[model samples]
Target: MMAKIKEFILLKIVIPIVDMMMGMKISYWYKKINKLNSLSRDKITEWQNRQFRDLIRFAYEHTVYYKEIIDKSGYSIDDFTSTDDICRLPVLTKEIIRQRYSDIVPDNITKIPHRKHSTGGSTGEPLRFIIDENTWGYVTAAKIHAWKTTGFHYGEPFLSFGSSSLFRVNKKNRLHDIYYKLRNAIALNGMNMEDSICRKYIEIARKKRVKYIYGYASSIYILASYVKKHNVKYKLNAVFTTSEVLTPEYRQVIEEAFDSKVMDCYGAHDGGITAFEIERGSYFVGYNTFCEVENPLEISTLYCSNLIDFAFPMLRYEVGDAVVMDNTANTHYNGQIIKKIEGRTGDIIRLKNGHTITNPGFTVVFKQFNVKAYRIKQLSESSLVVTLVVLPNFKKEEESKIIDTIKKYAGDDCEIRVEYIDQFEPLENGKRRFIMSK
Candidate 1:
């Protein structure tokens, strides 16, 4: 009864204000998904099968890009009855998105405003994709559902160190600034953080009694290192890490520092792969996202088919992450468990000013550049070598702007060398590490 009262006042009341102000109608999606999460395994499977069929048929009929691929392949949409037959179709890659950019989107996307997105260029070349109302509507809904996995109740505050685009404090938006505070969520600059900022981070966390902390594994690991060294304590309920790979060592440091469990999360830019850690080596994949493991013996890429994203069908989309699994989860599949997440890991770099930051954090600097791909490496204590594969349409002036952004974080004394390249060298496993520090 007390929980219900808390839910009514905090979730139903305060969260609704976020819905009203932001106009995302997040509460509607949140409530709907909460009930669906309680359904039987058989029921969820039945719904997923239906959704899979609907998505494949819709894509084959509507989108020209899917049409060519389906027509070329001997298999019909009828063959894909479940996850069993999705492999009959060829794996879709980021290269396909680049080739068939215009034709890949549904023809009726103009019916409502479409949101544009791009990958972080971590996996490979960053490819721009479009998400219509359905994509915007359901993906955020699934994310809210994923939040439950972090032990976060609806109304509790979260101090997020997310992508600079969303987290940056925009002084121009006065109304939004007020609403941001009221939502009990605060966004801190993860990219350019130093000891002074990290100290403020712990201070705010302690003062607000923030229930959760969200950031990239490396970014939080840096903060965790700080907290452990100083022995600062905050009433932290959980630490949520995402973006880069969450190794066991990083998890140990972060959890110990915050005096809370670290919950690792995985999601893709294409709105397909969504998962949150349930136990150390197990993650419960979101109900809306049906996943099939590809190359199980090797890199173990996840083919995510988003049931809710009809505006852009993500049928068997290869979200860039490698993994291993086991039959330990009884609820979702027959004990199907994600035993490990084998993504990229690198050391954080110390700037000339004696401040340290995650090397992957530098990816934010290259966001404005229309480069096809990039990789950053710490050459020495105060030097970085950035290799970029520029797109045909990229401008020269953007190069200067990117350099300025890097220097803003690393300081002017950091020996910076920008190398324009036709292509970047991939690792032995064929995946590129976005950041490398010796």
Candidate 2:
């Protein structure tokens, strides 16, 4: 009875107070540490290998699913001592994780108490996942690191144009909102990026003296176009673009309008920062994970192992985005190379006529025509609406060439309409989706 009473008191009072104090301490330390240079590639690799081994061992011993796989493969946890040995393990896919979520996660670790989140099914199938206290810590550290790289100081006001669930914005979201506000970051829902909303965002940034702007690359580009069209003036330290492909043309337009250098960051819901742009337009892998670039002739997929996620071990998880790596000699331990993320797997358009094409194919065609940022929407079975944010000096002949290219690539039966707009629309979550099917 006494123990039960003590447990109740701890849950009702002591734990809440402890959580708040710890959060504050972590936030303070995060701000301080993010400014320091990240671990060198060698140290980062070593640390990741150690963590990978530990996570694999833990999963093998505690998770029945992993145990079965390991036992069948005739390999003990000790076999995975080096990074190269990771290739021997079967690649983890989203389908496998979704199908066997409970079995994949170790039973030993208690779930961190928090609300669960489901991905918006933007990729065709919505995925449900748990987000706990540790998830927030890793996310916070990554964001802080990315911002610091682009000269964002802690407590400096900034703007985030991303989606927030309606329920999250209520009293329940108050604590998280307060934490963001304390960091001087405003959460402007990405759904409201129309002309009026874009104007309001500009007004807020100018008024608040927001030093940096970060959001979906497409969303930021839309706002940038609006700013350029209206001649809005607001000096910014930098613009960090994520959650969508940051094409070179998009980067150029954003830099021109915002008057700040545009940096790109790549990550996902299952993992934290995989790559971030540093000086000289080079991308450096983040510290908490080790990644391998499997380069085919035309495309590459990044296989990553999370060094921190012991609760849910992801060994050689296939992050389904294509990348281009630099072919230089010993720069960093794991081949310090730049990554050009070619968008996600779901960024493909399936025609009603039973043909499928990817965003990269369209991108290649767009490059051939030298068009500005564009989006393709399949409006009907035989029709496609291509919208382009017209660049200054864009020619009619070039537009015709783009239409012709689409006709050739998409097929002769499909009717392609090219619309020149001031800017393309951004999604509710601040993602700039290039291909949308209706």
Candidate 3:
């Protein structure tokens, strides 16, 4: 009864008041700033380079981890003549962050208050990290930029299919929830993606008149499928997919269902929002992050330093994701801008027999077979279970061809079993894993 009363009071009272205050603050900044849309590529590049140098120097001076490296190598921040100099620094990985979390933080800025963030164990291990309040603002600004590209107005209503840990619904959470509802978004718990739950999602969007939709690509695809099959109509301006790789097939379904173009955005929890679509159909790297593509081919890794996250300095932090770069000449910078992003390093699966295969490899094989959706499960040392949602056009001959391809890639001795299903099971975080190891 107390919980019910709290929910009513917070949702009906406290939330509306907070939302108005926050909205006014954001509006004030929007008015003071010059329009970013007016800036040319050269102007943006110039701004980003200046911010990059400052961040690099700050990290070298304050963070013990980066300071030690600079001192040991007898190098100063001045040695970094260009962004290319970043390559000279050692690549930072998740393991490194986990092991030396304390040392990486600056001693001078001790006890910096930060907001906690959690990543779904999509790679079989969940990770928790912290970012400063200002870093959070930078993320919000990136979202605003992306939304503007999609024709969304400031303070406009949009739906976001994200997660929250605050179950048992207290007053604070209830208030937050109501604020989201008023802003035309409903935060569906990412941990649940059952058909019934997804139905609720569709219902909310329909009622709220949400203009744009954004969330994990996999979850959005699932919701798109539900909308298509049910013939549900919701007038949406655009769909922005993030966090997971947006496949061509998923994009098609989502576009058809929502009657809107699907745009892809890429970022990480560690304060770097570097990619967004411009009015032109091409993606522009946001002015906030200094980004570099370490290697591009079968797998591409991104190295970035956040200009905004001064509290926790991440200089040349290697974010482990693969990407494809465009052939365009970056006159301002020396490297090509990233054209396409594939999947993460964790998305790749290594066979027991020593053969390493990426998600694209499986995608190629699945497309040839015309499978609707599939998941590859490494069952044992020498066994694989390929769970597929068989399409109406699937045939026995196609199955044989798929098996042959799998055997060729995985080796002759490996046991390959195919299982057909109506649909793939959803992960706890509302993501559908295309591959899993058991």
Candidate 4:
């Protein structure tokens, strides 16, 4: 009865109140999404076409970066009739964003309030940008709608696995605890999933009657392995995995352990690309994002444009993932479908002393620096090399801090070396590997 009351309050009173207080239009977006969900394929495409044209025109007129590029390309904003016409514009890469940060922001940025955010260092390129309340509202609504397709409700009791640096349990931040408590969700540290920690989380899930589980693919896989090994049982509505590739092996074990289906979601928050799995191998791209594959029929790079976000226009932005789009469009939801996505995969480094270190542990440490890109190469069991591409603000003294962080995970006696580079050479697959073991 209490859960039902809380759900009602969250979906009704609290959400609207918060939206009004923050000047967010989440309620407005919810209505828009509801309307879109019922529209026919032609209607959806019409909406997409209008939004795409508006985004291109807005960026060309408002942002210095896009204005200069569109002019150089010899194509005016008027030429962009369909989403496919975005190919005429140059692809925006992380390097371009880092170099031309100020130009990408709208000329009237000061007049429009926004929240500054930074992406995770998982891609070796952590990007900082601004997002207005409207974009935030749309993303929130899209996520809720995506999860709802898998029978998840807002304010339900669930467990979320995320970065440890962001979701710590220390008493330093009681509001974090209170926030999750109110949401009826628990946030577990994803970086460290030792057997004991996984066991504690498993017990916590059972005690809390958690109906859904959401988190990184690797962390959830580790927890699922432990659950299967111990013959522990759980009945859940579904497991939603993201941020990394959900391998077949990972999906099978997770479903068997929790007795639920696994739904995979792909999102590039910085690039504003979001898609959720609707069937086994097909993903339904949300109406708000214009997703493009550089080479459509074959496995190629993904570029996206956010139709709603104009505060900082990421036009034709490379999302740094390998994907193959289904040319055979499903006549549902603007006919956009991702047949396969080759998301990031985590690699572990096992020391001679039996201690293991993973990529995410280093990612958390690197997040504090002004690193443009990084790569960790394990030359041998005891020797490791970290190559970094840093911005002008990065100081020499920070090198010691990075070494200390690496030693913290890899052990003090391990031979560590740091080298500075301008940039990295892309692998054959066109994606950068954060960790490499020779």
Candidate 5:
């Protein structure tokens, strides 16, 4: 009752004024997204065909790298009449994005309202990119639309377990405090999901009547396991898991604990792909991304083309995930369908003192450095080795900062060592694993 009243005021009144002040029309995009969600399958596909052609033409004219690639491939921009023509271009890998970052971005970037962003380094290789405000607004709208499928209304309280570096509030910012309060969000540090912390989160959720939970799959699974163990009495409308693989076992446990559906969401932000599970075993891919499957027999890789992001367009970008594609008709949505996503399977690292560091947690400190790739191996519970493949701009002093930041999580008594390497040896599975233990 209270939540509905707050939602009415916040969404209708507060949000518009905030949008007007900030010069961002996320609400406008949100309304458009709701309309897009109701479009017919054929109409959505037609829209995608047009958007893809425009994006390709824009990339060829604005970006140096795409112009060279298209020219060298003996293909003209006019040839991209349909979305299928994207297969002709070479796949844009993480290495290409890193080496040719400047050439890939447009010359008129200074005039755009974009922010510097980095991937969570789930694959042990983080790619930094730019996302304009337009793209940001669309993504936010799409996310809210996805949440609404689970009967979640905006302005309702929710619990988020994520990286402390990203979600933790700045003590000095009163506005941020007010924003979280108004939004009714409680963010707990996912890196340290100890039993005590998990218990406190459950208490807060029970007290606040938070019907939604969102965060990394492994972190949520850990909390779910604790809930099931203690026989905690909690019921939620939905559990939204992202940023990591949602295993069958994890899904069963989470759904059983919450007595609700677990909505799995996938987003390759750099490549601008987003999908949300609307039903069991059926994921609805968003209209803004044209997803293509490569080598699909049992498992396959995904190549995503961002149809909306014109400022920094990633045409046919390799997302580096193995997924199962559903060939069934798009009965649930106007867009494409994915059967299951085999995302980055994150592992939990336990310290000698019983503290834990979750997947992509260490990736936070590496973002401040110019390190290209990194791996953390636990030689013993107390001793650790960090191997890094750094770029030319990587400074020597950044090494100590990595050690200090890690020790803050792993503990002050933990023995840490850092190693620099040209590259990592190829794995048998052909995937990079960052968190490992001997």
Candidate 6:
């Protein structure tokens, strides 16, 4: 009962003494997500239409912005042979990939592997792209089959309250602290979280054996509202919310403060979109990726054709968020599900050490700089109001480097008020609250 000898020295003596001294194979993405969850649903729609016609014939044979938007949308790859011509092309926003991220990359920059990847101006600014290794093994096998729908296993013990996932257990890289202590993680930095480091990881998650507690549904509902107001006896087998918008009152307060059960994984980080959840809360948009709706069944605007990155070819791409679909899908992942995924809210700030962070740490400080839109308004608990909309190569020391990166996380006795907007006014259900805190 020494919490079962610290779960037997972290599962029988430090995980096989750090997986046989780092020969590493930590379940290798749980055996490629159990062979993609033993396929079927017509062999995942014939391997998603042969990986969407081999990324539309490798983006019209080695991109040039997908051969001038598929030769000016007269569409071909023989009119997308299947997936019903994914809306005969057109819909790749984020101001057309920030007005052409150098002609949507890929000028045969192939030494035959890729990786740059950026995004933290969450659907408005910061975008850097390029991801290979077969689109990171189908976005890490659809986030380990959406954390195997809450019953997560394979050497289980995860704790990602994101905003730059804080890694600790004294890391100074000794094989990255024995690879995050044999992959039984303990990352913290949910944008500066710390109730004495969340009660020292809730007393080492009530002794070792911790399993699944994912991130950013407003920083895991501010660590389940301080572990349900200090009655922190722990135990969890599920809680995977992602980026934001979980609301059913934050999924009944993150399922009554982590007694557990609440899996959500709606996507975007421009890897097109994933949409995990598998029933009762819907979301099955799997079979890699291929979805559309610029206006179909209301809260529209959501186009994606990311058959897993294909070295930056988000074909019908527009993932600037706004979804809603209850059905449809003539195969490939059985039926289209995805009902409700409103525009971004994963908002939360609270810092001065009491800790809580959101929107992956304030959109990575507006990633360098250049904007066509921006927002962040908290108004109290140490005021803030920083609306911006510049971009004609904005400069004035980049508005004092964007108010010194929002006064480095609205602290230093917060009072950051830097406004400059020529436009932007759409709430009252017309969406646009990239991060708000009333």
Give the TM-score (vs. native) of candidate 1. Answer: 0.88
lDDT of 1 by residue, 1-438 (tens): 543465466556665665565545557767766776777766777777887788788788888888888888887667778756677777776777778787878776665355677766445476778665454545566665666666566546777785664334455355546544555566776766678878988888877778688887877887888888888776467888887888778888888887888888876758555677766667767666777786555547767777766667767777766777554436544223566777656667786676565655555556667877787778888888888888898998887787777777678887788898888767765678776775
**Model 4: colliding residue pairs:** none
Relative to the true structure, candidate 6 reaches a TM of 0.35
Q: What tens digits encode model 3's per-residue C-alpha lDDT throughout 46-123?
A: 666676677678778778888887777767778865565667678776667777877777776645545555443223
Give lDDT tens digits, candidate 2, residues 1-438.
Answer: 543454345334443454474432334325433532444556655766776777778878888778878888878778978677778788887778788888876776564343445442223233455544544555555566656666565566678765542125444455544544455567765532456668888888888878788776766877887888899877677998776778777798889997898878777656544567765456766555666677633446767776556556777776665567665543433424554666542244556664544442343345444455678888887788988876577788887788776765467778899887775555543236667766
lDDT to native, each model: 0.70, 0.63, 0.61, 0.78, 0.79, 0.66
- Candidate 4 versus truth, CA RMSD in Å, comes to 3.3
**TM-score preference between candidates 5 and 6, better one:** 5
Candidate that beats the other on TM-score, 2 or 4, i.e. the better one? 4
Give the winner by lDDT.
Answer: 5
| Candidate ordering by lDDT (highest first) | 5, 4, 1, 6, 2, 3
Writing each residue's lDDT as its tens digit, candidate 5 over 114-166 gives 77788754467677798866777677778877887788887788888776535
**RMSD of every prediction:** 3.3, 13.1, 12.7, 3.3, 2.7, 19.4
Whole-model lDDT, model 4: 0.78
TM-score for each predicted model, relative to the true structure: 0.88, 0.69, 0.66, 0.88, 0.90, 0.35
Clashes of each: 3, 0, 0, 0, 0, 0
The candidate maximizing TM-score is 5
Indicate the worst ten consecutive residues by lDDT in candidate 1: 327-336
* Poorest 10 consecutive residues by lDDT, candidate 6: 21-30
> Which residue runs does candidate 3 get wrong by more than 4 Å?
1-37, 110-113, 120-122, 165-182, 190-194, 279-281, 296-299, 327-337, 344-438
lDDT of 3 at 294: 55
For candidate 4, the per-residue lDDT at 121 reads 33
* Regions of model 2 farther than 4 Å from truth: 1-40, 111-115, 120-122, 165-167, 170-177, 296-298, 326-338, 345-438
Task: List the lowest-lDDT window of 10 residues for candidate 3.
Answer: 24-33
